[model samples]
Target: MIEEIRIENLGVIAGARVELGAGLTAITGETGAGKTMLLTGLGLLLGGRADAAVVRAGATSASAEGVFLVEPGSPAAERALEAGAELDDGALTALRTVAAAGRSRAFLGGRTVPQSVLAELAEHLVTVHGQADQVRLRSAARQRSALDAFAGPTHGRLLEDYRAAWTERQRLTVELAELVDSAQERVREAELLRLGLVEVERVDPQPGEDLELAQEAERLGHAEDLRQAAQVAHDALMGTDDAQAPPGAAALTDLARRTLEVVARHDEALGALAGRLADVGYVLDDLAADLARYADEVQADPGRLAAVQDRRAALGTLTRAHGGTVDDVLAWASTAGLRLVELEQGDDRTAELRARLEDLTGDLQALADQISSGRAEAAERLGAAVTQELAGLAMASATFSVRLTPTPELGPWGAEDVEMLLAAHAGAPVLPLGQGASGGELSRVMLAIEVALATAPSSARPPTFVFDEVDAGVGGRAAVEVGRRLAELARGGAQVLVVTHLAQVAAFADRHVVVAKTEGDVVTTTDVRVVAGPERVAELARMLSGQEDSATALQHAAELLERSAVGR
Candidate 1:
């Protein structure tokens, strides 16, 4: 239940705070008095699209904030938790803001959140029965939902369980269907993959082989260049000037030996330097010998280079298509090979998969059958109850029913569609609600369902009922009946709000707000005041006779309030 709403710089509403209460509360005003602004503020708080135009002309931004007294396990609380926001059942506040740039922000229970979450939370908090809302009832989807809601708890749960099975089977069906959808394409892909695997297997490229081969080919391609470089280095280490000498007996070795001998006769620092030089000389002698052997091995080989080049080029082509590295290509081939084996098992695997599909389908069909049976039983009870409510709403001779029929195809919602059918008077066959009822008749029909569904003990989540102009085009006994029923719904602890011009409707409200507007160059602003005692009677008199000052109108307003109290 919304406990209060505060608005600042929102359209024509400069700054207003209205404290709402439990039970039926009505917001009434003269035309152009900005009562609709209250509803507009609600829409934004509930994640409606924001625009700079909604901001008051002289103001920089607009803000809407409200306090919602919540139940412990209400859908609104669950939505808040789902959004990574806390739900303080101790006190829950829903807030929204629109900046001059038209960007919007939302908050739930003091935690900043996304607009969608705020909207979802709002869904269970309030139901606005505005003019546009009437159009929404036209869709087949909405019709189906309303009928299901009317069908009550057992029917709803059965549908849920049935749809769960239906959903899982559908996922399997889609996966299996993908395999069937591309049979010809699969054959082509499988053939290509098989060819790739065969090629890689026959050639058998090894990982890291490319680097090793490139190094080898570089030497083989420029053998003379390598040999010259190695020979120059070996000669320099052994002494290059007309001396035939083993490297161990060459000049660098002799110089180090002589230096060490001199240092032995000198100080400690010279001896350490000489020892380091001697170690370097010994290392060079070993390296020269290795260089000579390496020189002997280096030689050009055109045929071997061509074979390596051709194989490397072939592997390169495979790398471009399959993977950049040999290991990656190999892994890809391995996976493709496994899948090919399965796809190649052909009809056997297909038949096995199809059999599982058939089993799931059979289970879903059985659940659907049970769901259909349960829905039929629930729908009858719901239809009769709604029919009885309609009788009080001035359609005494109306008939109502739910049409739940099965189809060949199953959807996320299950196999059958539920529709509402109604007849406004006797001797008329029941037709779809949108077709069989007039504008005013439709309003009453909706109210009847809302009032009925509000008190349904099995409703998983029931929104506060709102009846807008339900008393429109109806009066006398019919209008009084509407008031009585609304009062009853309020008595049931469902927060009920109505917007009506009739005193009958206004008298039913436990609390009433009257909206007054002033005219100026820009159409000044609106004032909303909660009325009671004499103030309420005056407002009701204005509503009843359009002239509150008249004596008869005041008496009539008093009688209406008195009778409503007695009726309660």
Candidate 2:
């Protein structure tokens, strides 16, 4: 619900503030007293297109701000919070400014925001209807939604189930298409993986086998040189059997140790030197044995070297194809093997998906049928109810109906397109809403539809409803009915503001605001104020006649107010 509206530099409004609350509010004034400007300001707050021409003369800019009371966890409140807006105790402030130079800006709940954000939030906040601002229920989709909402909670659940099935069917259809389209590609991929795995298994390379084989091959390639070197070193370490041969390293070290031992009886330092020489002698003996064994073991085998080289060449092929090393080749082979299995299962998976899709198709058809049935039943009742409302709104001869046209194929909404049709009077052909009524009739038609929908058990109502001269061509008893219905709509916990010139309609408002124009030396300004008692009577009197001081008009206005109060 809107708590207040503030306007500045907008047309003849200059600066004005209108405090609003629950129930019906009537804005009435003289022909040029700026009543339209109030609704235009409201349009700005609703994120309507900004025009620099609407700014007051000599003013730099025009601004409109609205304070709305929203539920704490409602979608509008959540959206404002998401945009980093700070709501003051569940009251959201929406402001729009248009500069004379054509620049425009919007703010929501104290935070600057994109104009589209305000438009999006408006869906949950207000519904505006007028000769030029018929925004709600303008499309087939929205009409279908409104009808579905009127169908009650059971039908709503059925629609939800159908939607869920439709979503799943769409997902499955896309998945199946992908699998079928990529069938040939998967076959090619599987063949490549199979060939790579075959090569790896044929080589049978083990982890670290390539490096070990390379080392063995290197030793075998130079076996003769290695054996000769080892034999020479062995002979030097251990003395040769020939008596003329010089003493080997072990024998020389042992001789030095004995020499030191004899002299060490007189010196402790010499004894330590002898112990070191003894340790060196033991190391030389061990080295001579190891060298002799190495020389014997180091025999050149051409056949073994050839076999090792062949194995290395085969493993090299595997490494080059799959990886850089024997271990990497093995790892790649393991992963490829798994992929090959998955690729081989593609046909089976495709068959399963086809079967599941077929089943889902059947399910979707049944659900669509059920939804269409429910909609058809609801459409009849809704049409009758709205037609009944039109009679009271002075369209007694009119006939209204909801037409459901079946589509050739299923759509997101269902198997049918929902449209509202109207015939202006008896013997007239029924036509779509906009084509069948005049601007004034269309506004009444919209109002009747709203009142009819409000009677539905599951209808979701917007917080505020704005009607701009919806009573334009309506008068007499019909005008009182229009006022009664507007008040009735507001009584259902909605804030309704109607721009009206009819004293009959304005008299029924819970709060009546009169826009009074004041002429100054250089400029004309309009002041807006809530009127009651004599002031309200005078305003209604002015509406009934051209003169507020006319006693007959005053009496008539007073009687109309009394009648409205009793009807309320």
Candidate 3:
């Protein structure tokens, strides 16, 4: 339930706040007094499209904020919490702002969020029905929904079952079509996988083999130069054929160690130096032996060089076709083999899909029949209840009907189409709601339907309902009946807010709010305030007559209020 709404800089409403409660609350005012601004504020708070034109003149922005008291585990509360909104004390604050530059923002429970978040919450929070909704009721799909809503829990369960079966049938049918349609594509893909696998298996590349082979090829291709360089380095490190050359480092280190050993008797530091020189001599000898072995091992093998190069080329070809390296190509081949098996199983899959499709179609047909039967039963009850409501609305001779006609093709909803038909008077041909009824008559018909649906024994209805001028063109006792039925809906545990001009309708409000406009030399502003006691009567008087001071109008307003109270 919406506990309150605060609006700023929106239309002629500079700033106003209205505290709302459960039951029927009515907002009324003189023409041009900006009563509609209340509903407009609600629309903004519910994430309606924002327009700069809604901003007051000279104002930079317009904003509307609402506080809703939600059930503990309701969908609305869950969604707000999911958006990181803090639902403090079970109250969620929804806000929307529209800048004069056409920018818009939305907030949920003080957290800034996308406008769609507010919209999703609004689905379960409120249901707004205005004069335009009467036109929407003309649609066949809308008619179907209305009938189902009025049909109560039994119809709801049937629809749930039907939709589930229908969805499965659709899924199977689409899969079957796709599998049949793309047969050639699947075949081509399988053949490509086969060829790739054959090439990879034939080459049989090993991981890291490419790098090792490349290194081997480089060494073999320069075998002569490598052997000569190795021999020269070995001879230089050990000794040369020239005897005049300074003794090799090994011989020099040995002579230094021998000199240090002779001086060790004179100085301790010289003894330590003698030991280090002896270790160096040992290392030089080991290096000389390793160099000689390396020089002997270096040899040229053209046959092995050719074989390594050819193997590298084959591996390179595989790498180029599949991946950047031999390992990557092997990985692709492994995955491709799995995919090839799946593709080759298409024939088996087709049989399986055909079997599943047959089972789903049978299930869908049965569910559709059940849905049609439920709707047929509901149509009768709905038509009777609405007709009874129409009688109270002063349309005694008019007949309302719900027509269920079967279609050749079953749909997600059902196999039948629904039409809400009306006959305005005796001897009048029954026509669809869109074509048969006048605006005023349509208003009454829609009101009747709403009242009937509101009285249904279902807990799935929206918490708040805003009806903007739903009583349009209605007057006399019919207007009073409309108000009474609205109050009835409220008594059914839903909060109803009605925007009305009729005194008869306003009289039935559990709480009355009046939009009062003040005109200044430069600007006009509207204020919304709750009216009670004598103030409400005076406002109703003003609605009944042009002047609130008129005694006759005042008396009529008083009696109307009294009558409405007694009726309640």
Candidate 4:
């Protein structure tokens, strides 16, 4: 519910504030006293289109601010919190500003927000019914929406089930058609994979075999050169053909060790040096044996070398076509094998999808039937409830009915077409609501429907309702009945604000606000003030007889107020 509204530089309302609460709050003023400006401010708060012309002259911009008491954990609070907005003391502040240059801005809970966010929040916060809304109610789509809202959860659940089945059937049909259309492409892909797999299997390359073969081929190609080098090294280390080779290195080291051992009794340092030479002689002997073994093993074999080179060339083909190495190529072959299976079974998969599509089609038809039945049942109860409400609104002989005509083709909603028709009086032929009801009757019918929807067990009633001049053509007892119903609707815990010129309707408000305008030489300003007690009675007197000081008008206004208070 809106706790307060502060508007500046909007229309004739230079600066004004309105305090609201749960129950009926009526806005009244002279026709040109800026009564509509109050509703305009509300419209701006709800993300309505911003008009530069509405900005007061000489003002840079016009702004409207509202403080709403949001229920904890409600959708309104959640949306505000999602936008990084803080809920202070369980109240959300929404503000909208329209500059004279046509720029518009919206703020929610102290955070700048898109105008659309305000609109999304408004869906759950308030429902505004004005003279224009009645025209909208005449539409077929609107009629369907009202009926569906009245139908409650049973119709809602059935509609959802039908839409789900319909969506799945559409998906399956599309997939099956795509598979059939791309049959040739699938076959081409399968054949490519088949040929690649065959070549990889035939060669059967080993992991890292290419690197091993390259090293072996290099060794075999230089076998003779390696043998010659090893023989020269062996001769130098052991004994050569020439005897004057200084007895090779090993004999010299052994002679040095014997010389040191003979002098060991004379010097201890000499004995240590002789021990190091003995160790060197053993290492030289081991090196000579290894060189001889290497020279014997190094033999050239052209046949084996050529076979290794040929196998390497074959493995290179697979690597270059598929990957950089043998292992990478093998990995590709493994994945391709799985894909080959899917491509080969394309026809089987297509058949499976077709069967699924057929099954979904049947399921969708059944669900559509259920939805149609639910709507049909709801249409009867909704018509009776609304007609009963209309009788109380001073249309005693009027009758309302909902007609559901089944169509051959199914739709997302159902196979039934919903239409609301009315009989204005006895012996009158039923006609569409737009053609049968006059402007005043239309107002009453819409009010009845709104009340019914608001009171529905399944409906999440909006916290506020703004009715702008909805009682345009209504007067006398009809106007009083409208007031009574508005008060009744408010008693159910909603903040109802009705903008009306009738004193009867205004008397029913728990709080009354009057917009008074004063025309100055260069500027006109309007202020909204809360009226009560004798002040409210005077305002109502002006509404009754265009004379606030008249004794008779005062008496009538007081009587109306007393009657409304007693009725409540």
Report the CA-based lDDT of candidate 1 relative to the real structure: 0.77
Pick the lDDT winner: 4
Q: What TM-score should be assigned to candidate 3?
A: 0.87
Summarize candidate 3's per-residue lDDT along 418-471 as a digit string, tens digits.
Answer: 998999888899998969787878998998888787776663678898999999
Q: After superposition, how far is residue 394 of candidate 4 from its true place, in Å?
A: 5.1
- The true-versus-predicted C-alpha distance at residue 233 of model 3, in Å, is 2.8
Best candidate (score: TM-score):
3
Q: Model 4 TM-score?
A: 0.75
RMSD of each: 4.2, 5.6, 3.4, 5.5
User: TM per model?
Assistant: 0.84, 0.76, 0.87, 0.75
User: What digit string (tens of lDDT, one per residue) describes model 4 on residues 154-192?
Assistant: 777777777788888778878888999999999999999
Q: Return the number of clashes found in candidate 4.
A: 0
Error of 2 at 458 (Å): 2.6
Candidate 2, 206-282: lDDT as tens digits = 89999999999999999999999999998898889989999888888899999999999999999999999999988
**Each prediction's whole-model lDDT (CA):** 0.77, 0.87, 0.87, 0.88
Of 1 and 2, which scores higher on TM-score?
1
